[model samples]
Target: MRLAGNLLLAVLVLAALAIAATYWRAGQREAAARAAYPPLGQILDVGGVQVHAHVTGAGPDIVLIHGAGGSLRDFTFDLAARLSDRYRVIAFDRPGHGHTDAADTAGRRFDAPRQQAALLQAAARQLDIARPLVVGHSFGGSVALAWALEQPGDTAGVVLLAGATMPWPGTLNASYRINSSLLGGALVVPAITAWVPLPYARQVLAGIFAPQPMPESYPAEFGLPMALRRGLLRANARQVNGLRPHVVEMSGDYPGLEIPVELLHGDADEIVPLHVHSGPLSALLPDAVLTVLPGVGHMPHHAMPDHVTAAVDRVAERAGLR
Candidate 1:
């Protein structure tokens, strides 16, 4: 009896240690991430959430939306530099990602489409972005699609980079979904992530950009501030949780898209799975043109920027901008 009691006590102690260790590590990592990526500019209040955004260049207006768990920097840093020369490039953090305020629920807060469309409309009004071409990556791609579908004739064009336009695959099980929330997003997750330095999470993100090395600035670009980490996680969780419903809601109307659309996808994409997403999305948009990169992964903009730029230019030409 004494041995059994001792064994139970040991397990409790070990569990306590594990939790403590996790908490400590999360704090350390969050600090590192924040220190690494300093905020670049002021925040803009849009639809109840304070969003981080940057704008540059001139001529036609273009908005770049980063994927789930990504920030405005993802697009603004490299791609924006190249595109901003001719087009006014605007990259804004979504409701939950980057510097955006995580003040609401996934479903009720800013549903992907509503938030995106409203944001574009608001940012356009605030920044004087007019009939801009919208470009989005991963989940951001879906928001772009949703916005286009919602407004019909309002948008000038859309560029979906490895977009998660269709319903998500079943492989994204419960645990993955939970971790996407608990480990990667929101206040609690970011708080934990801040200290933990989740290598697996980093690996998964890196894999999407496979055949390409992880960006040197990935941690800074993606890691949320400790204060905002949980908000990021919650927002990301809401994004995936409502993904299927959003896909279902938008699929029926995709065929009706009147704006010019271009889809750039890496044939080797593993994260959102190209065949499941881009395949059907290309078929759905009547005016959509598809470009497939053989060796690239999900982040085609980063992996194949030249090709991506050409595609964007093509869209611009079609829109009569170039």
Candidate 2:
């Protein structure tokens, strides 16, 4: 009986040690991530939330919103910088991603694309951005659509790069499901944040851009560590897991939109299937155009920048910004 009790005590001690270790490591990693990828833009206070906006170049305005688990760095890596030459580019770190704080004081998760669009529009107004061409990738695409639907007069045009438009059929990945839950966010998130290595993060990114080579400089430039921060990880999971229902509701509103939309998607994109999103989206809008790359993957902005650039240029012309 004593031996059994001792064994139980040992198990309790080990579990306690593991929890303590995870907490300590999580703190360390969070600090390191902040130091490694310091905000590259000005933090503007919009309502109660803080938004990070990177503005550059001088021409007609172009706002860029990145996908899930991404920051303005995703655009700055290449697309935003390149576009800046021809347009005034404003890349935003969406609420709950990168340095942007979720402004919902009620502590409600800022997962709905409409909510995100409202926040981003408020931020753009503060920066004096008016009727800019908006570009959204992946999850950002959903936000762009919402922006156009909610305030059609304010958006000049839209460019969707492998945008997530339609309500996808399957459940989110197991990791997103787990981390989105209260218990998982409280426990599993911290554990992953604490113990996940850079290579593992890279592996996940590679999968996102599968069938296409990850740009060699992407890991460093895109700030992988920022995405792994505990708060951001939980926020991303919540947004991703809750996205489908929101998309379903939003998809019905697309037919009423009047703004010009140019969608560039890869036929090989497994992340956001081409047939499911851009394909149907084109048929829904009166002025929408869809371009399918023959053998590209999800990261078309990186894999085929020239095509993306041309699409943006076409939108600019259509919007009379050219």
Number of the predicted model whose TM-score against the real structure is largest: 2
Among the numbered candidates, top lDDT falls to 2
Per-candidate alpha-carbon RMSD to the true structure: 3.7, 1.2
Per residue, candidate 1 scores C-alpha lDDT tens digits across 1-322 of 9999999999999977776776676666656656776656557766555667788888798888888767887776589999988999888877766666655333356646656667656755778767778898988888888777666666789999998888865646563366455444433454455454456566666765787777877644555343235556666767667778778787888888877889998888877777888888888888889888897887888888898888888888888777
For model 2 the local lDDT of residue 133 reads: 92
**Which runs of model 2 end up more than 4 angstroms from their true locations?**
none
lDDT of 2 by residue, 153-249 (tens): 9889999999998987767789898998988988899998899889988999988888988988899988898888888988888888889999899
The superposed Cα distance between candidate 2 and the true structure at residue 139, in angstroms, equals: 0.6
Cα lDDT of candidate 2 equals: 0.90
Give candidate 1's error at residue 118 in angstroms: 2.2
CA deviation > 4 Å runs, candidate 1: 1-28, 104-108, 180-195, 198-202, 215-228
